[model samples]
Target: MKRIGLTGGIGSGKSTVASLLVAEGAVLVDTDAIARSIAQTGGIAMPAIEAAFGSSVIAPDGSLDRVAMRQLVFTDAGAKTRLEAILHPLIGTETQRQAAAAGDHAVVVFDVPLLVESGRWRTLVDRVLVVDAREETQLQRVMSRSGWAPEAVRAVIAQQAPRKARRAAADAVIYNESLTLAELGTEVRGLWKLWAAATTR
Candidate 1:
Protein backbone atom coordinates (compact mmCIF):
# COMPACT_ATOMS: atom_id res chain seq x y z
CA MET A 1 0.00 0.00 0.00
CA LYS A 2 1.20 3.48 -0.83
CA ARG A 3 0.01 6.24 1.47
CA ILE A 4 0.42 9.53 -0.36
CA GLY A 5 0.12 12.75 1.61
CA LEU A 6 -1.78 15.30 -0.48
CA THR A 7 -1.58 18.88 0.75
CA GLY A 8 -1.88 22.51 -0.31
CA GLY A 9 -2.62 25.87 1.23
CA ILE A 10 -6.19 27.08 1.51
CA GLY A 11 -7.65 28.13 -1.88
CA SER A 12 -4.84 26.25 -3.62
CA GLY A 13 -7.29 23.94 -5.46
CA LYS A 14 -6.39 20.87 -3.38
CA SER A 15 -9.92 19.43 -3.46
CA THR A 16 -9.91 19.50 -7.24
CA VAL A 17 -6.70 17.50 -7.28
CA ALA A 18 -8.06 15.12 -4.66
CA SER A 19 -11.25 14.58 -6.70
CA LEU A 20 -9.22 13.82 -9.80
CA LEU A 21 -7.17 11.28 -7.85
CA VAL A 22 -10.36 9.72 -6.47
CA ALA A 23 -11.71 9.45 -9.99
CA GLU A 24 -8.57 7.50 -10.85
CA GLY A 25 -9.27 4.92 -8.06
CA ALA A 26 -7.21 6.26 -5.15
CA VAL A 27 -8.99 5.87 -1.78
CA LEU A 28 -9.18 9.31 -0.13
CA VAL A 29 -9.10 9.94 3.59
CA ASP A 30 -9.78 13.69 3.85
CA THR A 31 -8.74 15.03 7.24
CA ASP A 32 -10.54 18.34 6.73
CA ALA A 33 -13.78 16.49 6.02
CA ILE A 34 -13.20 14.34 9.08
CA ALA A 35 -12.57 17.43 11.18
CA ARG A 36 -15.76 19.04 9.88
CA SER A 37 -17.75 15.92 10.68
CA ILE A 38 -16.39 15.71 14.21
CA ALA A 39 -17.09 19.37 14.84
CA GLN A 40 -20.62 19.37 13.52
CA THR A 41 -23.67 19.30 15.77
CA GLY A 42 -23.67 16.43 18.29
CA GLY A 43 -20.39 15.22 16.80
CA ILE A 44 -17.68 13.23 18.56
CA ALA A 45 -15.65 16.32 19.47
CA MET A 46 -18.55 18.52 20.58
CA PRO A 47 -18.42 17.77 24.27
CA ALA A 48 -14.72 18.55 24.49
CA ILE A 49 -15.06 21.68 22.37
CA GLU A 50 -17.93 22.96 24.44
CA ALA A 51 -15.99 22.23 27.58
CA ALA A 52 -12.87 24.03 26.39
CA PHE A 53 -14.32 27.04 24.57
CA GLY A 54 -17.67 26.97 26.30
CA SER A 55 -21.09 27.65 24.68
CA SER A 56 -19.57 30.78 23.20
CA VAL A 57 -18.13 28.68 20.43
CA ILE A 58 -21.22 26.55 19.86
CA ALA A 59 -24.12 27.60 17.71
CA PRO A 60 -27.83 27.41 18.56
CA ASP A 61 -28.16 24.24 16.46
CA GLY A 62 -25.28 22.85 18.57
CA SER A 63 -22.73 22.89 15.79
CA LEU A 64 -19.28 24.29 16.40
CA ASP A 65 -19.31 28.02 15.70
CA ARG A 66 -16.70 28.11 12.98
CA VAL A 67 -16.63 31.86 12.59
CA ALA A 68 -16.22 32.39 16.31
CA MET A 69 -13.58 29.74 16.66
CA ARG A 70 -11.70 30.93 13.59
CA GLN A 71 -11.60 34.46 14.91
CA LEU A 72 -10.42 33.29 18.30
CA VAL A 73 -7.67 31.10 16.94
CA PHE A 74 -6.30 33.76 14.62
CA THR A 75 -5.83 36.11 17.55
CA ASP A 76 -5.12 33.61 20.30
CA ALA A 77 -2.51 30.88 19.96
CA GLY A 78 -3.59 29.26 23.23
CA ALA A 79 -7.12 28.83 21.93
CA LYS A 80 -5.88 27.30 18.68
CA THR A 81 -3.55 24.92 20.48
CA ARG A 82 -6.31 23.86 22.84
CA LEU A 83 -8.70 23.20 19.95
CA GLU A 84 -6.07 21.26 18.00
CA ALA A 85 -5.39 19.19 21.07
CA ILE A 86 -9.02 18.18 21.22
CA LEU A 87 -9.43 17.43 17.52
CA HIS A 88 -6.05 16.28 16.11
CA PRO A 89 -5.94 13.00 18.07
CA LEU A 90 -9.43 12.01 17.01
CA ILE A 91 -8.73 12.96 13.38
CA GLY A 92 -5.47 10.98 13.41
CA THR A 93 -7.11 7.88 14.84
CA GLU A 94 -9.96 8.03 12.33
CA THR A 95 -7.56 8.68 9.44
CA GLN A 96 -5.48 5.62 10.33
CA ARG A 97 -8.57 3.45 10.67
CA GLN A 98 -9.91 4.59 7.30
CA ALA A 99 -6.53 4.07 5.61
CA ALA A 100 -6.31 0.56 7.09
CA ALA A 101 -9.82 -0.22 5.92
CA ALA A 102 -8.78 0.78 2.39
CA GLY A 103 -6.88 -2.57 2.37
CA ASP A 104 -3.67 -3.77 0.76
CA HIS A 105 -2.87 -2.94 -2.89
CA ALA A 106 -4.83 0.31 -2.58
CA VAL A 107 -3.27 3.78 -2.81
CA VAL A 108 -4.59 5.66 0.20
CA VAL A 109 -4.53 9.44 -0.25
CA PHE A 110 -4.56 11.46 2.92
CA ASP A 111 -5.94 14.85 1.91
CA VAL A 112 -4.64 17.08 4.64
CA PRO A 113 -4.43 20.88 4.71
CA LEU A 114 -1.45 20.98 7.05
CA LEU A 115 0.57 18.03 5.84
CA VAL A 116 3.71 20.18 5.60
CA GLU A 117 3.37 21.44 9.14
CA SER A 118 2.75 18.04 10.67
CA GLY A 119 6.09 16.25 10.73
CA ARG A 120 4.28 13.08 11.78
CA TRP A 121 2.46 12.91 8.43
CA ARG A 122 5.73 13.16 6.49
CA THR A 123 6.95 9.95 8.10
CA LEU A 124 3.62 8.21 7.49
CA VAL A 125 3.27 8.85 3.76
CA ASP A 126 5.48 7.34 1.09
CA ARG A 127 5.36 10.51 -0.97
CA VAL A 128 4.22 14.10 -0.46
CA LEU A 129 2.19 15.51 -3.37
CA VAL A 130 1.92 19.26 -3.01
CA VAL A 131 -0.60 21.16 -5.12
CA ASP A 132 0.90 24.56 -5.75
CA ALA A 133 -0.33 28.00 -6.92
CA ARG A 134 0.60 31.67 -6.55
CA GLU A 135 -0.66 33.72 -3.65
CA GLU A 136 -2.58 36.14 -5.88
CA THR A 137 -4.39 33.24 -7.54
CA GLN A 138 -5.17 31.67 -4.21
CA LEU A 139 -6.59 34.93 -2.84
CA GLN A 140 -8.85 35.42 -5.87
CA ARG A 141 -10.11 31.83 -5.83
CA VAL A 142 -10.79 31.92 -2.11
CA MET A 143 -12.53 35.26 -2.17
CA SER A 144 -14.70 34.28 -5.14
CA ARG A 145 -15.62 30.81 -3.93
CA SER A 146 -15.89 31.52 -0.20
CA GLY A 147 -17.23 35.11 -0.23
CA TRP A 148 -14.52 35.86 2.25
CA ALA A 149 -12.90 39.28 2.55
CA PRO A 150 -9.46 39.57 0.99
CA GLU A 151 -8.00 40.38 4.38
CA ALA A 152 -9.53 37.30 5.90
CA VAL A 153 -8.19 35.12 3.14
CA ARG A 154 -4.75 36.68 3.44
CA ALA A 155 -4.75 36.11 7.18
CA VAL A 156 -5.39 32.41 6.65
CA ILE A 157 -2.66 32.26 4.07
CA ALA A 158 -0.25 34.00 6.41
CA GLN A 159 -0.76 31.24 8.95
CA GLN A 160 0.05 28.45 6.52
CA ALA A 161 3.50 27.31 5.42
CA PRO A 162 4.68 29.51 2.54
CA ARG A 163 4.75 28.49 -1.11
CA LYS A 164 8.52 27.97 -1.16
CA ALA A 165 8.46 25.78 1.95
CA ARG A 166 5.68 23.59 0.58
CA ARG A 167 7.52 23.24 -2.71
CA ALA A 168 10.66 22.29 -0.84
CA ALA A 169 8.78 19.53 1.01
CA ALA A 170 7.07 17.95 -2.00
CA ASP A 171 8.13 14.66 -3.54
CA ALA A 172 6.18 15.76 -6.61
CA VAL A 173 4.61 19.16 -7.20
CA ILE A 174 1.52 20.01 -9.26
CA TYR A 175 1.70 23.64 -10.21
CA ASN A 176 -1.68 25.33 -10.69
CA GLU A 177 -0.32 28.45 -12.32
CA SER A 178 -2.62 29.30 -15.25
CA LEU A 179 -3.26 25.66 -16.07
CA THR A 180 -6.68 24.76 -17.51
CA LEU A 181 -8.88 22.04 -16.05
CA ALA A 182 -7.93 19.65 -18.83
CA GLU A 183 -4.25 20.21 -18.16
CA LEU A 184 -4.74 19.70 -14.44
CA GLY A 185 -6.57 16.44 -15.10
CA THR A 186 -3.73 15.29 -17.28
CA GLU A 187 -1.22 16.06 -14.56
CA VAL A 188 -3.23 14.09 -12.01
CA ARG A 189 -3.55 11.06 -14.29
CA GLY A 190 0.19 11.02 -14.87
CA LEU A 191 0.88 11.20 -11.14
CA TRP A 192 -1.69 8.49 -10.46
CA LYS A 193 0.13 6.12 -12.77
CA LEU A 194 3.36 6.68 -10.86
CA TRP A 195 1.72 6.15 -7.45
CA ALA A 196 -0.20 3.12 -8.72
CA ALA A 197 3.06 1.63 -9.91
CA ALA A 198 4.47 2.05 -6.41
CA THR A 199 1.54 0.18 -4.84
CA THR A 200 1.50 -2.64 -7.38
CA ARG A 201 5.18 -3.31 -6.86
Candidate 2:
Protein backbone atom coordinates (compact mmCIF):
# COMPACT_ATOMS: atom_id res chain seq x y z
CA MET A 1 0.00 0.00 0.00
CA LYS A 2 1.10 3.55 -0.74
CA ARG A 3 0.41 5.85 2.19
CA ILE A 4 0.13 9.35 0.80
CA GLY A 5 -0.24 12.43 3.01
CA LEU A 6 -2.43 15.06 1.41
CA THR A 7 -2.21 18.54 2.93
CA GLY A 8 -2.77 22.24 2.35
CA GLY A 9 -3.48 25.36 4.31
CA ILE A 10 -7.07 26.35 4.97
CA GLY A 11 -9.19 27.01 1.86
CA SER A 12 -6.55 25.69 -0.52
CA GLY A 13 -9.01 23.16 -1.94
CA LYS A 14 -7.35 20.23 -0.19
CA SER A 15 -10.72 18.57 0.39
CA THR A 16 -11.69 19.04 -3.24
CA VAL A 17 -8.49 17.37 -4.34
CA ALA A 18 -9.00 14.59 -1.85
CA SER A 19 -12.57 14.05 -3.11
CA LEU A 20 -11.34 13.77 -6.68
CA LEU A 21 -8.66 11.30 -5.61
CA VAL A 22 -11.26 9.27 -3.72
CA ALA A 23 -13.47 9.15 -6.81
CA GLU A 24 -10.48 7.86 -8.73
CA GLY A 25 -10.03 4.90 -6.33
CA ALA A 26 -7.83 6.25 -3.55
CA VAL A 27 -8.85 5.04 -0.07
CA LEU A 28 -9.41 8.30 1.78
CA VAL A 29 -8.98 8.80 5.52
CA ASP A 30 -9.78 12.26 6.75
CA THR A 31 -8.09 13.29 10.00
CA ASP A 32 -10.29 16.36 10.43
CA ALA A 33 -13.41 14.21 10.39
CA ILE A 34 -11.89 11.87 12.92
CA ALA A 35 -10.97 14.78 15.17
CA ARG A 36 -14.49 16.17 14.91
CA SER A 37 -15.90 12.81 15.91
CA ILE A 38 -13.56 12.62 18.85
CA ALA A 39 -14.46 16.11 20.04
CA GLN A 40 -18.19 15.63 19.87
CA THR A 41 -20.08 15.85 23.17
CA GLY A 42 -19.58 12.62 25.10
CA GLY A 43 -17.00 11.56 22.53
CA ILE A 44 -13.55 10.25 23.45
CA ALA A 45 -11.90 13.67 23.80
CA MET A 46 -14.83 15.51 25.36
CA PRO A 47 -14.12 14.59 28.96
CA ALA A 48 -10.61 15.96 28.77
CA ILE A 49 -11.77 19.08 26.92
CA GLU A 50 -14.57 19.81 29.37
CA ALA A 51 -12.18 19.29 32.26
CA ALA A 52 -9.61 21.59 30.73
CA PHE A 53 -11.82 24.32 29.29
CA GLY A 54 -14.96 23.84 31.36
CA SER A 55 -18.48 22.95 30.17
CA SER A 56 -18.98 26.11 28.18
CA VAL A 57 -17.51 24.47 25.11
CA ILE A 58 -20.25 21.87 24.97
CA ALA A 59 -23.62 22.56 23.37
CA PRO A 60 -27.14 21.66 24.46
CA ASP A 61 -27.37 18.92 21.78
CA GLY A 62 -24.40 17.02 23.24
CA SER A 63 -22.07 18.28 20.58
CA LEU A 64 -18.97 20.40 20.94
CA ASP A 65 -19.80 24.02 20.26
CA ARG A 66 -17.22 24.47 17.54
CA VAL A 67 -17.50 28.24 17.36
CA ALA A 68 -17.01 28.63 21.09
CA MET A 69 -14.13 26.19 21.16
CA ARG A 70 -12.51 27.83 18.20
CA GLN A 71 -12.66 31.22 19.85
CA LEU A 72 -11.15 29.85 23.02
CA VAL A 73 -8.30 28.00 21.33
CA PHE A 74 -7.41 30.69 18.81
CA THR A 75 -6.89 33.22 21.54
CA ASP A 76 -5.00 31.00 23.94
CA ALA A 77 -1.90 29.18 22.73
CA GLY A 78 -1.90 26.79 25.65
CA ALA A 79 -5.53 25.90 25.07
CA LYS A 80 -4.79 25.16 21.43
CA THR A 81 -1.85 22.96 22.32
CA ARG A 82 -3.84 21.11 24.94
CA LEU A 83 -6.65 20.41 22.47
CA GLU A 84 -4.16 19.12 19.91
CA ALA A 85 -2.60 16.92 22.55
CA ILE A 86 -5.94 15.29 23.24
CA LEU A 87 -7.05 14.82 19.65
CA HIS A 88 -3.84 14.08 17.74
CA PRO A 89 -3.23 10.70 19.28
CA LEU A 90 -6.77 9.50 18.64
CA ILE A 91 -6.67 10.72 15.07
CA GLY A 92 -3.31 9.09 14.49
CA THR A 93 -4.48 5.78 15.87
CA GLU A 94 -7.64 5.71 13.78
CA THR A 95 -5.78 6.76 10.63
CA GLN A 96 -3.23 3.99 11.03
CA ARG A 97 -5.97 1.46 11.71
CA GLN A 98 -7.84 2.48 8.58
CA ALA A 99 -4.67 2.39 6.50
CA ALA A 100 -3.81 -1.05 7.78
CA ALA A 101 -7.31 -2.39 7.10
CA ALA A 102 -6.96 -1.22 3.54
CA GLY A 103 -5.45 -4.19 1.67
CA ASP A 104 -1.89 -4.23 0.38
CA HIS A 105 -3.01 -2.99 -3.03
CA ALA A 106 -4.78 0.02 -1.61
CA VAL A 107 -3.59 3.54 -2.43
CA VAL A 108 -4.45 5.36 0.77
CA VAL A 109 -4.80 9.14 0.81
CA PHE A 110 -4.70 10.58 4.30
CA ASP A 111 -6.26 14.01 4.10
CA VAL A 112 -4.68 15.87 6.99
CA PRO A 113 -5.33 19.59 7.22
CA LEU A 114 -2.54 20.24 9.70
CA LEU A 115 -0.02 17.78 8.36
CA VAL A 116 2.85 20.19 8.89
CA GLU A 117 1.83 21.34 12.34
CA SER A 118 1.21 17.79 13.48
CA GLY A 119 4.71 16.69 12.64
CA ARG A 120 4.48 13.21 14.15
CA TRP A 121 2.31 11.75 11.36
CA ARG A 122 4.56 12.83 8.47
CA THR A 123 6.86 9.84 8.78
CA LEU A 124 3.94 7.42 8.65
CA VAL A 125 3.31 8.20 4.98
CA ASP A 126 5.36 7.37 1.88
CA ARG A 127 4.82 10.73 0.20
CA VAL A 128 3.51 14.23 0.91
CA LEU A 129 1.19 15.79 -1.66
CA VAL A 130 0.63 19.49 -1.05
CA VAL A 131 -2.31 21.27 -2.65
CA ASP A 132 -1.13 24.85 -3.14
CA ALA A 133 -2.51 28.18 -4.27
CA ARG A 134 -1.50 31.83 -3.99
CA GLU A 135 -1.77 33.45 -0.56
CA GLU A 136 -4.29 36.05 -1.76
CA THR A 137 -6.41 33.33 -3.27
CA GLN A 138 -6.31 31.45 -0.04
CA LEU A 139 -7.38 34.51 1.94
CA GLN A 140 -10.23 35.18 -0.45
CA ARG A 141 -11.38 31.59 -0.48
CA VAL A 142 -11.31 31.28 3.30
CA MET A 143 -13.10 34.56 3.87
CA SER A 144 -15.82 33.74 1.36
CA ARG A 145 -16.31 30.12 2.36
CA SER A 146 -15.99 30.52 6.13
CA GLY A 147 -17.37 34.01 6.60
CA TRP A 148 -14.29 34.86 8.64
CA ALA A 149 -13.08 38.41 8.46
CA PRO A 150 -9.80 39.09 6.67
CA GLU A 151 -7.92 39.44 9.94
CA ALA A 152 -9.31 36.18 11.22
CA VAL A 153 -8.38 34.44 8.00
CA ARG A 154 -4.90 35.88 8.18
CA ALA A 155 -4.58 34.79 11.80
CA VAL A 156 -5.43 31.24 10.83
CA ILE A 157 -2.92 31.36 8.02
CA ALA A 158 -0.30 32.76 10.37
CA GLN A 159 -0.57 29.69 12.55
CA GLN A 160 0.15 27.44 9.58
CA ALA A 161 3.54 27.02 8.03
CA PRO A 162 4.16 29.53 5.31
CA ARG A 163 3.74 28.42 1.68
CA LYS A 164 7.46 28.36 0.96
CA ALA A 165 8.15 26.28 4.04
CA ARG A 166 5.43 23.79 3.19
CA ARG A 167 6.56 23.56 -0.42
CA ALA A 168 10.10 22.88 0.69
CA ALA A 169 8.88 19.99 2.81
CA ALA A 170 6.64 18.49 0.12
CA ASP A 171 7.47 15.47 -2.00
CA ALA A 172 4.95 16.69 -4.56
CA VAL A 173 3.01 19.90 -5.18
CA ILE A 174 -0.32 20.34 -6.92
CA TYR A 175 -0.75 23.94 -8.06
CA ASN A 176 -4.45 24.67 -7.70
CA GLU A 177 -4.51 28.26 -8.88
CA SER A 178 -6.27 28.88 -12.23
CA LEU A 179 -7.10 25.20 -12.62
CA THR A 180 -10.57 23.84 -13.27
CA LEU A 181 -11.77 20.59 -11.71
CA ALA A 182 -11.04 18.61 -14.87
CA GLU A 183 -7.56 20.03 -15.04
CA LEU A 184 -6.92 19.19 -11.40
CA GLY A 185 -8.17 15.66 -11.99
CA THR A 186 -5.72 15.28 -14.86
CA GLU A 187 -2.87 16.28 -12.58
CA VAL A 188 -3.99 13.85 -9.90
CA ARG A 189 -4.13 11.06 -12.51
CA GLY A 190 -0.59 11.79 -13.57
CA LEU A 191 0.57 11.72 -9.97
CA TRP A 192 -1.26 8.45 -9.43
CA LYS A 193 0.58 6.88 -12.35
CA LEU A 194 3.87 8.09 -10.95
CA TRP A 195 3.06 6.75 -7.51
CA ALA A 196 1.93 3.41 -8.93
CA ALA A 197 5.15 2.94 -10.84
CA ALA A 198 7.38 4.13 -8.00
CA THR A 199 5.76 1.92 -5.38
CA THR A 200 5.70 -1.13 -7.65
CA ARG A 201 9.40 -0.76 -8.31
Predicted structure with the largest TM-score when compared to the true one: 1
Task: Give Cα-based local distance difference scores for all models.
Answer: 0.93, 0.87
Give TM-scores for every candidate, taking all chains together and pairing residue i with residue i. Answer: 0.98, 0.94
Model 1 residue 10 distance off true place after TM-score fit, in angstroms: 0.9
- Per residue, candidate 2 scores C-alpha lDDT tens digits across 81-121 of 88888787888789888888888999899998878876765
Residue pairs with colliding backbones in model 1 are none
Model 1 lDDT, residue 35, Cα: 100
Taking the tens digit of each residue's C-alpha lDDT, what string does model 1 give over 1-201? Answer: 888999999888899999999999989999999999999988999999999999999999999999999999999999999999999999999998999999997888999999888778889989999999999999999999989999999999999999998989999999988889999999999999987887656
Candidate 1 has an lDDT of 0.93
Error of 2 at 138 (Å): 0.9
Relative to the true structure, candidate 1 reaches a TM of 0.98
Model 2: lDDT of residue 141:
93
Tell me the spans in candidate 1 whose CA falls farther than 4 Å from its real position: none
Among all candidates shown, the one with the greatest lDDT: 1
RMSD (Å) per prediction: 0.8, 1.3
